[model samples]
Target: MNLVLGIDGGGTSCRAALATLAGDIIGRGKSGPANIMTDLTGARHNIVEAARLAFVDAGKDSTMISATDAVLGLAGTNVGGYRQQLEAVLPFRRSLVESDAVIALNGALGERDGAIAIIGTGSIFMSRKGAAMQTIGGWGFMLGDLGGGARIGRDLLQEVLVAHDDIRPGSELTHAVMAHFGGDPREIVKFAAASKPADFGNFAPLVFDFAARGDSVGSRVIARAVGDVEEALDALKLEPDQILCLLGGLAALIAPQLSHRYRMMLRPPLQDALGGAVSMAARLFGAPKGGADG
Candidate 1:
């Protein structure tokens, strides 16, 4: 039997699933962060680890990895050179690499034309109209990803610093952040100098939690993030009936904060990125030439 492998590699974790050519899932596995741009070595290791674990869970020999066709939906695949480097090292007979946003859109909408906004440790907006596709944002943490968890957490830290300097009134949220850093501004500075986006993203849930509790600074931070998300959605120019799925770890937390107009357009995803990878793999390798699978 020909086996297919599907991978969803993100800033925070990597997931792998093993399935038959017929699309019945046999097993799934998970591993640590696999963002190619941020940590290439770690990404490579985790991808292999997740795949191996999936095979193990499926009662297959690890050596079968080289015979499996793989489809990877990964963050940073759109960045220069990273895809090529990662592809060169992937342990599969054949592989396809696509942006995480692409898989999110595919899984959310299936064969239908629609849009998806993925907001996690990073953010991106993707839409498909007939045969045409468009993407916005997802330029990584430094340049874009405005409404993402990392950006929200970064903004929270900045607010905390301002509050510490008496430029803004301190609140429970700011005090908690300060306490997390041992109430030493110098420690926060040192951490920021060495931290990655995932590190900053670790604080994102706190922002949402505090916002839900009516903390002033936390509410402001969430509102600003929502505005950025809305700006990206507006730029997509979606049709009135196009289904919009908010995806990623922060999707549920952020959805309620969006404007009423956007909320009205929102719909739940049909599947997830890993499932889309599997569907792509089947399309690429499971059927005969000239068939609908491709």
Candidate 2:
């Protein structure tokens, strides 16, 4: 029987699903981070590990990996060179590499034309109309991803520093952050110097939690992040009736914070990035004759 694999790799984790070419999923697996740009070797390892586990769960031979077609929607693929490098290393009969935002758009909108804002450790806004697709942000944490969890956590740390130096009024949120570092400013500096986006993103939920409880610093930080997200959405030039889906870990928390006008356009996704990858793979590689649906 013909099989296909769908992968959704992000900064936080990598997920894989084994399915028949007809679109029925047979098994699923998950592994650690797989952001190619940040950690190529690790991403490659995790991708293969996830695929191998999926095959095992499906009760198929591990060697069948070479016979399966795959579609991967991953973070950091938008940057130059990373996709090519990953494609060269991937073991599959056929494969497609796409930006995480593209898969999210596909999953959220299906056959309809619409927009999506993905906010997790990173953020990207995408819109599609027929064959044309446009994107904003998602330049990675350092260069962009302004409304992402990583950025929000980074800003929280900055606020902690400011409060330490008496530049800003300290709040319960800042106090909790300082406590996390043992109340030592130098420790925060040390952490920041060595930390990756995911490390910073670990603090994102705390920021949202504090914001929800009316902490001034947390409210200010989230407000800024929400503003940036709205600005990116505005740049999409969406139609009045076009639906917008908010996707990823931070989506639910950020949804209520968006302006009422934009909130009205928001809708839940029909599927997720992994499902979108499976759908794409099914389109690219048809099911074998007489093969079961899954």
Candidate 3:
């Protein structure tokens, strides 16, 4: 019973699916944060926990995880040597780690030639034209991740600080944002010094909320973010009629705001990242197996 494992590990949580070479799902499981770049040891623990839980869900011995081959599409894999590092410590018989964006694109477009913009807590854009794949961004919140929740939330904090200093005009959005930080710019400064991307990302919804109410600053922020998204799409060189998917937490919120050109190309994803991992596992590693127990 040779079965492949698919794991989608992200900053928030990780999901695992055990399936056959033919793409029949056997069992699935989930666990907490698996962002290897931020917490390698914790990610390792959660990755294995999720895999173990998948085996449990399948009513199989969790120890059999060591016998399984796996494909893990994970957040933070694009940074440094974390992919190889995480792979080295994984409990699988064999494992391949890829950036989270890869699985998202594959899941959305299946085998078709298309593109995806993953705009969640972080941002990354990718396109596949046959075998050639092009990716931009996904550098994480510090260096890049423009148009993502972290970026949006961080910008809101900045707007608050500047407005407090009288350097910029304050709007309802900024005023509300300041209260989110105890109404003290000093508290925002303190929080920023020790905050993770998720901490800032928690405020992203507020930006969209205010923007919807015609808050000037919120509108400006979202407009800038949309521009970044369009810029990335333009760089992908996707022609008209090519499928374009906007995935992740912000996808629905950002969709209608995109220019008509991009809006016309949008389509819903066919499956989630875990599904993509299993599909990729079959293509990358299970082709010869042609056989799976479940």
Candidate 4:
């Protein structure tokens, strides 16, 4: 089939891009979650399903996937044994599995020596300097992910709780949070009891929006989150001229608020994770002739 496939599989969904060996993306499709740690079999199924759909989108039969070389960037692939397990089951001529973060870095930096901060429901920072690579703070939301959307949302809920108990003064933001729960502190309590990282992350945008409007509570929450981001970047010790790409859902909100130092280093991503997966695939296996990508 003289084609390649790029797959981006996360807890929420799996996205597949079908391209020629020459690097022109011809089709793309998405399917259900493909989190290997939690559900390896399901992840494999979804991955193949996404690939099949991509082929369909490109006006080819699903069977063409058997001849396609692919690179998949998937959540939980970094955990021991899971990546190999999924790799063995995928329906492709040659397939490589990499941590989701890797493809995102490639997508953002495009072989540049720099760093990336993915601030979504959770956050992680990564850097690549030639063959040397470093990672910081992708430890999930319970104890880590301090600078992520989930953490900011959790902080907001805590502020609401403290204000409700008279332990802290309430502000417009906190009061608004309380009002969200029908002005009942116990409702906040009930919601928090069952909330997941993304459940809390839902409130992250509100915090940043309030901060933009000069609300004290929102501003403080955002400031702390910004501090966490800066702390991670400081750990990387990036060079002055090296670019830093901010990605994920909260990136837009956090970009303007970064310190002058990082602001100077910031640049937009060169491509998205799917594009990166395709790029990696092209590099690992020779692309077809007549491609002008170079």
Candidate 5:
């Protein structure tokens, strides 16, 4: 009958869930972006609001949640500054802060030893060893996010601009990107300046579409993305038999194009990232506040 709360802070939305100690979900909730680096105030508001809604969905109150453990897996909280900022708000009997990648890795592998390759707004590879951890990539959406949606979208935009200027071979993506930007090339510049990683990532589906229609540019884009992610995976020091789980948008889209050798290395996860928050909460039920249990 022990109650626990799990929070998954996505780039565009924040999701919260209430579950029993044994893992049966009781309720769910949601809010806006909780990426502290991108939007700190919005991040705190989203986390608090989502937690409130989750409690309401569970027919509980804040007091109950204050007694039960709450674990928040937030995006863009990779650094200590943002972590401390989040630590100042949010209610919990015990709470722990870590990057969203850590939660994704836990959600997939649980306590088991494995590696995770996440390709969403950003891309990162993480591996767990008992209680120890290691990572590669995760350099953020700006400089590095190779193989992520933002990267793909940036490449697509470049291709479209080149096509408009007659500097590259023509393809369906040219039209799609043009249409996506409302047929104005200047809109592309504005979009890049204003869009977040997830915003640009929204264009990834179009990349898949063009590739499916036999456009070499789109095909090459997909291949390049998959290859970049593979490089991240290969950098991990996992044993030959260790299973790697692929998370996020790009991984799911490009699975068909992945080689059998890579396929053999993958392990499908039983639960999504919210499950990781749940697991963390369970372990922290009796731990001191502000300490990590996993």
Candidate 6:
């Protein structure tokens, strides 16, 4: 029985899955962030630790199993030196490292060609055809990530502060946002200074809760985020009838709000992103370098 390991390393968390060639999941594990660009030492630690946990859960050992191949889908991995950084840490025979978005595309569409828009802490647009890849967004937290949770949270926070100062009409969001920051704007500012952008993004759930409860301001903010994702999808040049997969928390949650005419294009994946890594690893078992079709 061939055993393979698949890892999906993101800005916030790392997920590892151990599976057989036939796609039966033996066991799974998770750890901390694995984006090397953001935290190299921490990334290595998280990846190794997550792998070990997965091996243990699968009743195996990391060093003992000489798998035919492995695949790591990581965030913050561009097409340059950062890829090399990831290759240096994890131990594997035949390995391929790609952006987390690539794995997401694979997971959503299986082997079919299509596009995917992922909105979680951050958002990215990825379209793929076999080995060919094209990307539209995911510049980073500072200038880009327009429609992601961090963007939503940031805007909502500003509104909360503005409302507190009577610049805008107050809503339930003002109270929720204030409470999230311990009911102090100054403390919230300080926390903002020390937190990762994704940390802000995590607060989106609070906004969602309020929106679900009929908070007008919160509902509008989330609605705008939904529109932003759709605009990004439209920028991908997808045909009106082409199938588009919506992957990630925000996209899946807001699928119902999308126009009914476009509903036909929106399909959820059968498995999550880690499943993509597992499938990629399975192909690497017998695939020669630059030999097998991507």
Best lDDT among the predictions, by candidate number: 4
Model 5 ranges off by over 4 Å: 38-42, 175-187, 286-294
Q: At residue 204, what lDDT does model 4 achieve?
A: 96
Q: Which stretches of model 6 miss by more than 4 angstroms? A: 27-32, 52-56, 59-67, 175-188, 212-214, 287-294
Which digits, one per residue and each the tens of the lDDT, describe model 5 over residues 84-124?
87777766666677778887888898878988888777888
Q: On residues 1-294, what C-alpha lDDT tens digit does candidate 3 reach at each position?
A: 478889999878999999877777799999999989889999999999998898899888888888888889997776689888888888888888988888888889999999999998888899999999999988879988899999998988888888999998999989887877788789899999999998889888889999999999999888988888889889999999999999988999999999999999999998888999989877776888443322
Worst 10 residues of 3 by lDDT: 285-294
- lDDT (Cα, tens digit) per residue for candidate 4, span 222-289: 99999999999999999989999999999999999999989999999999999999888877654445
Residue 147 error for model 1, in Å? Answer: 1.1
Candidate whose TM-score is highest: 4
lDDT: worst 10-residue window of model 1:
285-294
Clashes per candidate, residues 3 or more apart or on different chains: 0, 0, 0, 0, 0, 0
User: Which regions of candidate 4 deviate over 4 angstroms?
Assistant: 287-294
Error of 5 at 63 (Å): 1.8
Q: Report the C-alpha lDDT of model 2 over 24-128, residue by residue, as the tens digit.
A: 889898999998998999998998889999999988897989888888999878679999999988888777888887877877888788899989988989999
TM-score, one value per model: 0.86, 0.86, 0.90, 0.94, 0.86, 0.83
What TM value does model 6 have?
0.83
* Model 1 alpha-carbon drift over 4 Å, by segment: 11-13, 31-35, 38-49, 60-64, 89-91, 179-183, 290-294
Instruction: Please list the residue runs of candidate 2 whose C-alpha ends up more than 4 Å from where it truly belongs after superposition.
Output: 11-13, 31-33, 38-42, 179-183, 287-294
Error of 5 at 128 (Å): 1.5
For candidate 6, write residues 8-110 as lDDT tens digits.
9987799988888755678888999987886888887887778778888988866743443667899878746888877776566556788888777777787
Model 5's alpha-carbon lDDT is 0.80
**Cα lDDT for residue 155, model 2?**
96
Query: How much does each candidate deviate from the true structure in C-alpha RMSD?
Result: 2.9, 3.7, 2.9, 3.0, 3.1, 3.3
lDDT of 3 at 240: 91
In model 4, state the lDDT of residue 8. Answer: 96
Model 1, 1-294: lDDT tens digits are: 488888999877999999888767798989999999988889989998999999999999989999888889998787799998898888887878888878778878887888999998989999899989999998878889999999998899999999999998989999999998899998888988999998899999999999999999999999999999999999999877889999988999999988888888899888888998887777677766622321
